[model samples]
Target: MSSTSSDIAITGANGFVGKNLRNFLHKKKINVLGISRKNFRKHASEVKITSTNLLEPKLQTKLKNYDALVHLIGTGRRSPKSMFEEINLNLTKNVIKACKNAGIKKIIFISGLGVSRSNKSDYFISKYKAEQEIINSGLDYTIFRASYIIGKTDYLTKTLSKQMKKGVIIIPG
Candidate 1:
């Protein structure tokens, strides 16, 4: 891909970091293909990604012709139906497969900080597994293990703001 062809496919484009990244990339005149479970009715972007779920096998066909894929899809909030391994690790496997099928050799992944050998948390393990899959996938990749990203309406910030409204700001001794 040429330097001038900055067409990027961003999954989880509706997320806070994804939204901010899209805006930043757009300012640099990079064309972005926003892919998310949710619809962006008022979005500035024009490309419509038909596939919403990565698990679907047909997703690969729709993902073709992009310079690179920025995979931001993750679920920090887990439920009985959605386990860490299933959501994080499994989804990553599917993404890698889709990337290969679409002929996209490059991928940028958003992982988490503290995904270390010592950590035993399910979250860290899942992230580590996801990273390992990407490494073993034979794709040229950039992985970002971010601990936290603060935006005006970031998930953490918004959650804290809601707690503050309920007057639960705690000061641990």
Candidate 2:
């Protein structure tokens, strides 16, 4: 790949951090291919996106042209549509397989702040499992355990604001 080519693929590109990262990369003149489950057309028109589930069989083909993949598809809050093991662990496992198949050696994963084997929380355990998968995948990977990224409509800020309205705030360890 040449220096001027679009070499990055960002998963969950419709999310807050993903959008910010896309904008930041755009500013730096590094074009990226956005991958998300939903069709989010409200972002910069120059950025191209592929709307599909990460676990889809065609993921490797979609990723084949990219040099690296930024796996930002994990979820903290589990719902009927999204679960910890499925989104965090299974998706990550698929990503590793896709990366290997696509010949993309580099993977950048965004994990939660307190993810570890010792942490028995479902969320942390899922993240930990994802991290372990990446580590054992034999790929060049970078995992960032992000804490609270407070910005416009960020989850942490919104949660804190809701808690403040209730009169009592609980800070977990």
Which candidate has the top score in lDDT? 2
In model 2, what are the clashing residue pairs, if there are any? Answer: none
- The 10-residue segment of model 2 with minimum total lDDT is 42-51
lDDT per residue (tens digit) for residues 1-173 in model 2: 44666578888888888888888877876757788788776345344556555555666666777889899897887553348888899989988888888889999999999998899788898899899999999999999999877896888788889999998797876
Give the alpha carbon lDDT tens digit for every residue of 1-173 in model 1. Answer: 34666688888788888888888887877777777778763247536554556756556666776778999988777444348888778888988888888888899999998897677778888889899999999999999999888879997788889889999975535
lDDT (C-alpha) at residue 55 in model 2: 51
Poorest 10 consecutive residues of model 1 by lDDT?
Answer: 41-50
| lDDT of the candidates, in the order given | 0.80, 0.81
Instruction: Pick the TM-score winner.
Output: 1
What lDDT, from 0 to 1, does candidate 2 have? 0.81
Give the Cα-based TM-score of candidate 2 against the true structure: 0.83
